[model samples]
Target: MDQTNDTAETLTPQTVRHSILWRVIFYFATASIALSIVVSAALVVWNYEQQTEAFRERLEDIRVGYSESLGSSLWFYDEIQIQSQVKGIMNLEAISYVRVTDNLNINIEVGTRPHHSDIETLPIEFNGKPIGVLEIAFDRDAVIAKASRAAISTMIAQLVSLLLLASMLGVVVHTLINRRISEMAAQVNDRLSSNQYSPLAISTGKDKDEIDLLIQAFNALSEQMIDQLEQKTQAQQQLKTINLELEDRVKERTHNLQKTVDELNQTLAELHATQGKLIEAEKLSSLGGMVAGIAHEINTPLGLCITIHSYINDNYQVMKRAFDGGGMRKQDFVDFMGMMDESLGILDKNLQRAAHLIKSFKQVSEDQTGEHIRRFSLHDYLHEIMETLSPKFKQTQHKVEIDCSENLWMETFAGSISQVVTNLVMNSLVHAFEHTKEGLIRIQAAEEKGNIVIRYTDNGCGLSAEAKHKIFEPFYTTKRGQGGTGLGMHLVYNIVHQRLKGEIQVEEADQGAAFRMVIPKITEESNVQ
Candidate 1:
């Protein structure tokens, strides 16, 4: 029972609030309209009855008076006569109707327009049986006019009273309910504001109404929410402690990470230094070997020069000794001159060879000057590189063929091109001639695709796949321990990419490796230096 009461109480606010006033309006408005209609109909009927009764009473009086005196009988007439009669009746302020009837059931009302939808036939007791039936149609318009006036007055009064009463009652109910609810809610809010997690103790007592049930359920829900909020608060406090610990851990780890990064940077610097040293050492070793061979090769020319000088000195000494010893002769003098002439020729040839060697070396290592812009024959440039590297080629059965070209370039960086060509040729000699002999090198240049492509191809051993991949990496060399400087190809890559601002690539062929370099053509604006 309590549960059912509680359930009903809980639902009352939703159900009763809507049903009450609408229900009142439904009952009151419907009853009022119906009562007014019924009252109007009854009043109309009563007025009609009174009019008929009064007329019948007057007829009775007239009959008695006629019996006592002397008068004729009365009868209805045609429409004109009935109108005259009705006008007289209306002047007398009596609502009446006249009708003309015969012995048959036919009835003709004595009026221009008769609006009565219902007409009753009754026996006239004048002579006993009905001689002729006369139905006095009631004047309903007048009665309805009075009734409608009464209804309007009643409607206005009812509407005003309903409005005032409903407002007053609604105010009283709403104020009482709101005051009680507000008081209880304020207590709950006070508890909530103080601790924010306090339990609600909304007292519902025993008379559990709708508000009581609502407060009970809300208090339960609020208590549950308060419990969850308390748990969340405790969890947040614990999380704050964990967050502080995590901050310390993060700081510690960040310091360690920073230390590791610093150490890695230092180690990288040292490694770069070591690599630079190793590359320099390898270059120096290759240079030393080349220098020794060049020295030995130049020794021949120097020896020739020395021999020429020595022979001339010896001849002079011999002439002096012979002349002092009284052995001077014209034939001997001619022979000595011939020998001197031969020595001169020999000295000139050897000295020229040594000078050529020196010149080639200087060209290979000379730094580019000024803006590094110049113009020269592409054929000559290619030929010069071939001449410079010809020594290494001479050691083997390999030979490079150059296609002679006329003045071609209008602007270029000569030193950078030289380095690229030098590296390409050196790469070919070092890597391509692994296990073969009688190799061939071809240096070809042509105008292609708005640029010049200088392709240095070889018919020696082709590039291995691994060598092709690592060929451009700095300090990466296939001949890592085999006296390779490794900086040669790196320098070539840089000169082509960075110095000339062009591009160079390599491809291993069936019998050799090919290096293709593409550079922009010179314009007319470039100086022909």
Candidate 2:
């Protein structure tokens, strides 16, 4: 019998113990009951306080009414009116007693005075002067009785409503939440006790409650765990096989990477060399254009000189032949001399102009190519630059003006400075005054606060907002298809900011674009490559 009892106890499935649903239901019931009780008590207390406040407000109204009436009665010295006012205050439910006294030693009392300590005194005033004193006492018993009745009624109603709410809630919880949770817990326990990896067999209805969602999640987790275990076993077998070739694969990849790095280094070096050559080629191309312009400019003066010389030679020959033939009179001789003198003067002027042009061209060309630091007068240097660039503007109506201080000098990279100024002037001619017939470029330089400020302004079509923003960026041009290289302003920026250690900015202009460059004047020793 003892063995049979033990077997039966074991077969009971350990009582399938899971009381979380009951415990949760009980917890909710306890919380609901506690909340209801607290709310009921609070309502009762609030209602009581509100009733007491209403009683006090009633007493205040009676006191004020009596005071006003007594003030008029006492001022008129009417005893009957004063007594009538006191009796009216005593008629108030909360007013237990009313007393009135005056400066004339008159005293009046009404109603049964209360033993409560709550009392208020008011002085009747007539034209800002106290005429009498009115004392009013409130009946605490009546106020308490009314407040208690309201509180008791509220408590009873709250209790009944709370009881009905708790009962409904308990029924809903037990039927909808607790029972479903208990069934889920029993299925989970059975699965756990049997060490079964299969999903929960609990079926769900169309409503799909929380318990159904929990079962779905548990089933998905079970499937995922089974898949992971199989994957782990396969991964272990694959890992052993991969370890055999990992070292060799690593060596092969490292070798390939090293080869790729070597090729990259070679390509990088080639690119660097190519960049240097390109920059040099660009410089040479600029110089070639400058030389062609100078040559064209020099041809005009040289040709003029040759023409004058030929005319003077012909005039001399004719005068000589006339004299040799003995047909030269004094008048002829004087006219011939005068003509000779005029021809000589013209010849000299053309030759001198040609010489000056050649000199200016030489100086500018040397300064652009020398790459040397030199102390030079800024005013004279600017004039030389303008003169060298004169041929470019000679055909056009555009004019170049320089306004540099006479004493302003700098010991800096003249070659870079020459290139910068060349770029600026050329940029203006190409972009700034593209459609304009008449334009003006003003270049001004001054020394201020130990820095040279050079302002360049052009009275051509002012830069658009977009053009101004991207003007100094390389290879960015509005006239790209028109053979614009777009490197002019970029080179200028580099020379001014990088080579000369300067800063440049574009200033706002009304009808043109203005650029201001600030470069520090340093000694030759301080100038570095």
Candidate 3:
């Protein structure tokens, strides 16, 4: 008894409600009810239309049948007969009211008027002359009620037939499919509880159907799942062991890598510091070379001035002695005046030349040393750079030509430009024109598309492909041991790009290495310095 009670308790409301048999019945019943409602509605509407049309035809028939009789009665003043015909029309179920009226004072109405009805009026004429009119009102409610009754009967019959069919289908489905599915589910539950996977053994009928196929497929899937689960379990164990070893190895490797990274970072920082010092040293070295060149240049003019001064002093002494002894002839005095004029003229010219050289040296040296942004004539600045570097080329037959518009002006770091131009000239004299006697260097500047374009070219032994490629790399010198610091072109590249905020490229040239640069006429506001 307790076991039976337990069984009943196990079959909970959820299970009973979700039974396959009941579910199928509910679905079929719902579909049947919906279908009956739609069909019944259509039938009711059709019947109402048919009935309404028939009643209209009946009204016409009654009017036709009674028209001649009523007309004759009206002609003979037979009021009682007209009254009788209207009363008969009221007896028909669809007719709610009837009225007859004549032109000769015969008027009769029968039956009470309904609230909702359709009224039809017939004109009565005798021999093509209007006599009276017959009116009939149809009861809309009565027509609807008749159609509904007929539809209800048909719908009831159809519902009974559909429900019976639904019941039969539900039974067939339960016997064929639901029972086997329930057994399969029970077997699955049993297997789960036992922790043992096996093939499902639900009985199939004599001929195999979808149920048999489903059982076979489930058995095959169960076998595959079991094999996969076993393999997964073994793999998990192996992975656990491997993961421990991998974790230790990762820890060791991470420590070693971090130490190496620290060393590299230290090395890189030192390298950067060294590189900065080298660059500063390179700049200072270039300035020192310029100073040496300018010193040599000033000596020429100063030496000439010294010789002229000595010559003028001797002439002055002779004149003084002639005047003191009273032996100074007029011709001697005139010749002395002429010598004095010529000597003084030579002294004054030499002094001016020395002064001019000094001024050019001062400006170029200041520009090379100080980072000052100034507006200057591009052509004149290039010439000043060449003049300062003239002594370097004095012994050689190399010459630099400047081709720039005098009106082209720039507002930029003139010091960086001076450094770049000086470096390029020195590089040409040292490397480009090393073997050539008469080397020509051309510096061209022009305003193009709102930018100052400078093209520096030298007609010497042009750079090889490899040299050209690495020309601007710091510490990469073609003349490695012969006083080549390798930073000349690198400095030019950095100045043009960094300080001047411009772009420089090695252009294809026929006879020399050509460097083309495009710098903004006015530096960008952010890079004004």
Candidate 4:
């Protein structure tokens, strides 16, 4: 018997002891009862008030009628008619008493007199003259009793109807929702207890209720879990197979990776050498351009000088022939002397100008190529550099101005300084004023606290924010593919910072680009390289 009991307990589906349908019914019944009580009490109070008001009005009407009847009877001295009206008023169910009185000493009364609290009085008149007063009392208890009965009957009806509604609702809820939910809960418990992953058998037909939907979702989730488990098992097998081949693949991959690394190292070395060659080529190209410009400038003056010298030589020959033939008159001699003086003056001035230009160019070119460290006047050196670059701007409206203290001198890398200044000026010509015809470049230098500060500014299109950020970065150029190797500014940056031991920075300008360079007048002992 004990074994049978245990088996039964095991097979029985676990369910909640309390029924949801009963709980819902109980709550609904409680609310209905509460509402009924409230409505019943309200109705009782309201009926009581209404009945009391009606009774008061009826009592008032009785008093008015009695006053009129008694007024006429007193005027005619008809005692019997007055008595009849008083008796009729007293006969009403809510009327407790009635009285008639007047100033002429006439008086009448009927029934037992009610207390003053229940009595009300009305004045009577006859032909615009005072005749009598009529008073009546109402039975308050009787009126309240009628209202209470009506309220009680309404309450009973509401309670009965509510009970029936609650019963019907409980039956429907249990049949349609509660029983199905209980069955679903039992099935879910059974699956959980037995660790079963089988899909639940639930109807998902045209009338798809919430319970049916929940069951369908649970079943789908079970199927998905089963599929995932199968996939996991298959993946484990595949992982084992992959592990078996991993060693061979690793060996092959390592060999390929080493080969790739070697190739990358070789490519990197080649790239470094190529970059060096490119930089050198850029420098040569710049020097070639300078040489071309200088030649062109020199040719102009040289050609003019040649023509003037030839003209003077031909005049001298003509004068020599005239003198030899004794045909030189005083006026002709004076004219010839004046022409000779003018020619000599022109020749001397042209030769001096050409010589000065060549000297400046030679000095600047030598300084740039020699990399000599020498004590030089900053102002004079800057002038020479500008002279060398003048040919580039001779055809344009751009002007270059240099301002430096005359006594300020520095023993430093003259070549690097030349390179730095040349790159900056060239950058302005190529990039800063690419669109503008007329521009002004100003270079101001001064010695400050044993350091030289050079401020360079140009009244041209200024560098854009992006350009300013990357202007000194190697191989970054806005004029790519147009003879811009992008090394000019980079070289400037390197020469100034690395070679000259100076720092250069871009600064805000009113109308164009500005740069500030601070270089030590005397190099540090350890940083001489």
Query: What TM-score does each of the candidates earn?
Result: 0.51, 0.53, 0.65, 0.56
Predicted candidate 4 versus true structure: per-residue lDDT over 150-227, tens digit per residue: 888998999899999999999999877887776776666566666667887656657888878888888989999989
Give the candidate number with the greatest lDDT.
Answer: 3
Poorest lDDT segment (10 consecutive residues) of candidate 1: 66-75
Put down candidate 3 lDDT per residue, 1-529, tens digits, no spaces: 5554455445544355578788889998998888988998999899888888988799778877988887787778778787787778777768888888888678888877554336688888777777998888887788888888988888899999998998899889988888777777677666665566688877657788988989888999999999999999999999999999999999999999999999999999999898888888999998898788888888888898888889878888988998999999999989988988888788888888778777878888888788777899988888877878888888988888889888889998788888888888888888888789999999988998989999999998888999879999989998889877887788888888888889998888898788999998888658755
Off by over 4 Å in 1: 1-238, 273-290, 312-341, 368-378, 410-413, 447-451, 520-529
Clashing pairs in 4: none
Lowest lDDT 10-residue stretch of candidate 3: 5-14
What C-alpha lDDT, on a 0 to 100 scale, does residue 345 get in candidate 4? 84
The TM-score, computed over Cα atoms with residue i paired to residue i, of candidate 1 is: 0.51
Q: What is the lDDT of residue 375 in candidate 1?
A: 75
Better of 1 and 2 by TM-score: 2
What tens-digit string does per-residue lDDT give for candidate 1 at 283-370? Answer: 4554454556566767889998997898899899998898899999988889998998988999999999888776765554452323
For model 4, the superposed segments whose C-alpha errors exceed 4 Å read 1-19, 45-68, 72-91, 94-123, 126-130, 135-149, 164-168, 199-262, 269-381, 387-399, 403-417, 426-486, 493-529
Model 3: clashing residue pairs? none
Please say which candidate is ahead in lDDT: 1 or 2: 2
TM accuracy, model 3: 0.65
143 in model 4: Cα distance from truth in Å? 4.2
Q: Predictions ranked by TM-score, top down?
A: 3, 4, 2, 1
